[model samples]
Target: KLDDADLKKGLERSISTDIQFLIAGQNSDGGWGWWRGSESENWLTAYALLGLHEAREAGYAVPEDRLARATRFLERWLTRTAELQDNATLDTRAFILYALSESGNGDESRAVELFDRHTLLDTDGRAFLLMALDNAGEGQRPRVQTLASELTARAILSATGAHWEEQAPDLRAFDSSRRSTALVLRALVRVQPEHMLLPQSVRWLMIAREIGHWETTQETAWAILALTDYMRASGELKADFSYEVALNDKVVLSEKATADNLSDPVMLKVGIAELLLEEANELIITRVTPSEGQSGMGRLYYSAWLRYYLPVETLKARAQGISVARRYEAVDAATLESLGAAVSTAQVGDVVRVHLTVNAPNDLFYFTLEDPIPAGFEVMDPTLLTTSHAAEAPGRERLDPDDSPFWYDSWTQSVIRDEKVALFSDTLPRGTYEYSYLLRATVPGDYNVLPTFAYEHYYPEVYGRSEGSRFTITPTAATE
Candidate 1:
């Protein structure tokens, strides 16, 4: 229970720090910038406000003054757009309407006038407006309900469409004057939360991971947060990892601050955490974008390596219970029922769970029915038994194929030789994925039986192929 408080305290500290960046981001035009300057961008201002609001809800202590200023910036921008007759800007209109709707300004004269009946029906604008209405508890209105059904239908059909080619709404269109279809997901996920499709925001994140773009620890952190948020909301897990990079004994990120480009901005996620990181003393990402030169969008790590070590070391400690925290292994769920991480020595009647940031292609990671392992949990191999030996340990009973009838393998004709090497290979597909698996205590044993990865494939060397991790399963007798 206290963990929630502790996490909240940390989030508050982060929220407190992020307010400055967003405030400083306002331009002379009364709107925020993509970073700190260039222009008073309305879209950036809107997203910044949205992000800060989310932070506040997450229990981050965002300042009321900052919120007021940001809200005013949005209001002014909306008022200016209406006066100028440029209400066709899908992203801006949607955002402004959302701001107005969410703030109880829907009944206000300005908001009533801003809701354009003609353009509200436009696909992009309609989706965005619906999101605002939904949040405003006005989605039940005839117009809002119609759009909601339409989006829910789109979300359902997302699985059959030409995903890579079909263009969706792009929020990033406001920036760099280019249409980045990635933003469409922001609207889709918000309005159709119950639908099964994976959010595009998550898919972009998954793409980033699939491409191994998280070389620096900064990239890794953002990716973790984004993936975690998407997965948490989706009510399912992505069985595969979009990307994985090797970690040497050195720091996980570059020593110097990164350079940003128009193609890749200094802030990728566009959230309060990104803003908090931008203000840090040392940055996790060192590759600067073009915006960094003028906008000052890079983020830094305060403790240097402490944050880097937290999640990773937690994972390394699971095998022997070296760390009080839990570490989950990554499991591939191709053709399998539902594969998750395991705690060693766990029994048939316990619940095994995993904690991970995942982005499956769509809703590929979930099933309508519960997995089949509930009757009596039997680990395929707590050790992920890649290697086998005929000789049994002093306490381990001999396997005559009768006692170990559940055991599987390549061929029974060939006499088993060595238990020292992997029997077969589990090929990872070409795309990238990030995953974590854990066996919960309800699955039954006091101790965990962790598995080990035996194969070795350099991740940094071959970005085109799959790489696997290994671990050892030590059965600690159940304490209860």
Candidate 2:
């Protein structure tokens, strides 16, 4: 994120592209779904609206009419659900409150009512409620402070240190531990910076560095956001400080952080106008605290943000690099008529098919794609998958089948238990590729297919995901 003065000149193009993507994907009734190819939901719409509001605050030109329509959609949904005695989930209500308040669309009364009705006392739910009340600007500072303190009291201290748990005993527990900690930390930092819990949680975060880079996008984003906000709110420096910025191990700028300037973090900014940064280059920011002890090593606080400058040439090159697509299809063995890109219904023992395509600009040293077969669905002939590759350049060969894997390795078994089909390729040549697999429905109920992910070995940061899919299973053929 750039400063206010640099908003239009620095990140305007990228912000515009993201805003357009959200606008184009909005549902016709004015709500956005949690994922692509899904029906609108309350929580997802609120998240999208939150993102849109942030962009608008940064001076992006978001249509006022679109926001109005979205507000109407949320109001209607909430009113109808409440009338029908169908209470909204805590997560949905919290997000709706934050979104509506941030966007200046509605009051906080309904959200407060919904939150007071539920007493789950879970970490994620409680943290979100704290944030929702703070954002609502309802003069609930006392309530917010109390909630943060209560969360702090529930935290546990192991041999390692004090850290918050997910408290979600299901599949999400492992994946959400770091995320829950970050959310609670954010709430604490926002409401009561002077509380002792803030420093304890910060120390725990510093000690538990292994949980720093989580795999999921949301966890990583929240972690970064929480840490940055904490750093900014950490009050004045008690000791002398020196700050330095370097690019590729070469010093570019240095300054002393004294009581005069360090007292207010809002005025701090490190300009990089002269540095000619390129892709894949490292940037480092280091702050040094002098030791007051006789024999000791001084403390060093290092916080670095990736630096990327997108001029016309670099942008054009990125456009030609890589592309991937994944789709769900209902197939008919006899007629072969196109059923649809989405599967709506399935009976017991019915098989569902998935299609995947990838286009590579260069020979990929390693590539892998994985999808979780839903609980009620079983992979039919997991070994019966097929792959086809069209080489774009001569002498560029496909990966050897032996080096490729057909299913997920145990690496992620702790987080996900559903059987999934996977495809891996090493030394896959520059080409367009396609693959397909089958799964048989055995149980009877509604199920949502988790998102599929594609990863590149060399550039681990670069990845892609399929639009999430869902289908319903009936107990008998007559039910369908």
TM-score of each: 0.37, 0.51
lDDT by residue for model 2 (1-480), tens: 333555546577777888999899898899986444447867668778878888888778999878887888888777766633322345555556667877887556775675565355467667777887787674877667667777888787666456787554322122256667777888888887776666666666665443335455666666777777787677433335676777768887776655444433322234576445575566777764543532222233433433555432122212224565656667675433236666657788666666666666665544666766777886555233431121111011222335442432212111212577666654456655556655566899987666666666434455666555566888885545
RMSD after CA superposition, every candidate: 24.9, 17.7
Best by TM-score: 2
Off by over 4 Å in 2: 1-10, 34-37, 80-88, 159-161, 169-175, 206-212, 236-299, 302-480
Backbone N/Cα/C clashes per model: 49, 0
Candidate 2 CA-lDDT value: 0.61
TM-score of 1: 0.37
* Highest-lDDT candidate: 2
What Cα-based lDDT does every candidate model obtain?
Answer: 0.39, 0.61
Error of 2 at 100 (Å): 2.0
